[model samples]
Target: MASLTIRQLDKSYPLAKGARNLVLNKIDLTLHSNEFVSIVGASGCGKSTLLSIAAGLEEFDSGEVLVDDQPIQGPGIDRGVVFQSYTLLPWLTARQNIEFALKSAGYAHTERAEIAQQHLELVKLAHAADKWPAELSGGMQQRVAIARALSYRPKILLMDEPFGALDAMTRRQMQQLLLEIWETHRLTVMFVTHDIEEAIYLSDRVVVMKPAEIDQCIDIPIERPRDFSVTHHPDFLNIQSQIFERISQPLEHA
Candidate 1:
């Protein structure tokens, strides 16, 4: 478990006239140890940008980002990331994919094999350990990607719409599997997605982000061990509506 804190974060890209396109603005957020938080927003709202910065994949223009109160230097072993696209090395088998990540974390050949097998089992992909990425279905490939990400035992996990490319059924299944793993591991997770129900189903709190800043954050009052049935609960729909209202807020006229 770890603490992630971002204070007054800002990020912008250069525009045609040397002006900047502000993508993130004074984004302040914190995830307590073992908390599952999801960031949701309309397209082009900088949700992925914020997540990327936290993963140390991109730099912010200003403000401070810290993990466990320590300033992030760069992409470190302390954080693991999974994205919509399965970023697995194609030539490697499922098990080998995980082993490859462990190797970079400085595990010996023997330990890499052992740890790889263990994580594959954690994601219930042990049966397909030897299958190449091409042989695995979309869901199966994602499982392998998840296994590889977690094999190193990173303190926090950042997922950027990891289930976005999956079909509806597979997306549901993956969400269930992810929640199971999160519960078992007691992890600090920051997930970015455009799906409201998915966020409500998987997150302890859903943070609604505006185009260039956070709009609001709503706590999910539902009980844990969530399932599809939770979607039918009135409270779930109510929270979902609240988030929708925030996301749909119109920008002020210039």
Candidate 2:
């Protein structure tokens, strides 16, 4: 399988008095191609930082992160990122926002518009394509942001709490939307979320991270085209309970 491999990953930031705040230490993980992997842990367990390193936005002091056998160095079209806050450019309309990324990637004007529209439709935001970010609802803005990220057709989608700020109902809707997109696109996804149920519902494997290491990778064998109505099914509930138990543990002792 085409995969990502991380070995002995470590990162630390220098504090004011020459002290270093160790964030990640000896962290190792692997994500196969077309896999939906959810990472969950305490707030400061470096889950998001690990994704940053994978996306090449940050560097580790030691260790390796290789995607499909190549070492990651800097940001590239192969990796896409979506953050908690909808990072949309207020001045640009939804279509323009995606188009900007395409253009910056050196795509031609006609191709950029074509690809942007395609991705907007994929996220079900085609109708709001011409609307400015400020004019759209929070959900709509996030849809546009997701469209922009997928517009590049990146190999891996790196998400950091992309649905964290939405209301409960909207969050569920977005989660379903992501699953649908995954079904059709089959993009490798590395998602970071604090929501235990959401993590179990959307991931093929829920990776529980401890204070400075991964505790376990639990495979979710739930059948796809998942019905939200069956979210409380025995099997689903079992997986949810297991995840809840794991998530509730303190990272230091996990």
Whole-model lDDT per candidate = 0.93, 0.89
lDDT over C-alpha atoms for residue 62 of model 1: 96
Write one digit per residue (lDDT tens) for candidate 1, span 1-254.
Answer: 89999999999999997899999999999999999999999999999999999999999899999999999998999999999999989999999999999999998897998899899999898899999999999999999999888989999999999999999999999999999999999889999999999999999999988888888888999999888999999999999998887777776610
lDDT for predicted candidate 1 compared with the true structure: 0.93
Stretches of candidate 2 exceeding 4 Å from the true structure: none
The positional error of residue 132 in candidate 1, measured at the CA in angstroms, is: 0.5
lDDT by residue (1-254, candidate 2, tens digit) is 24778889999989998999998999888899999999988788889999999999998899999989899879988888999999998999999999999987778887998899899999998898999999998888998989999887788999999999999999999999999999988988999999888888899999988766787899988888786876888988898888778768765557
RMSD of 1: 1.2
TM-score of each: 0.98, 0.96
Lowest lDDT 10-residue stretch of candidate 2: 245-254
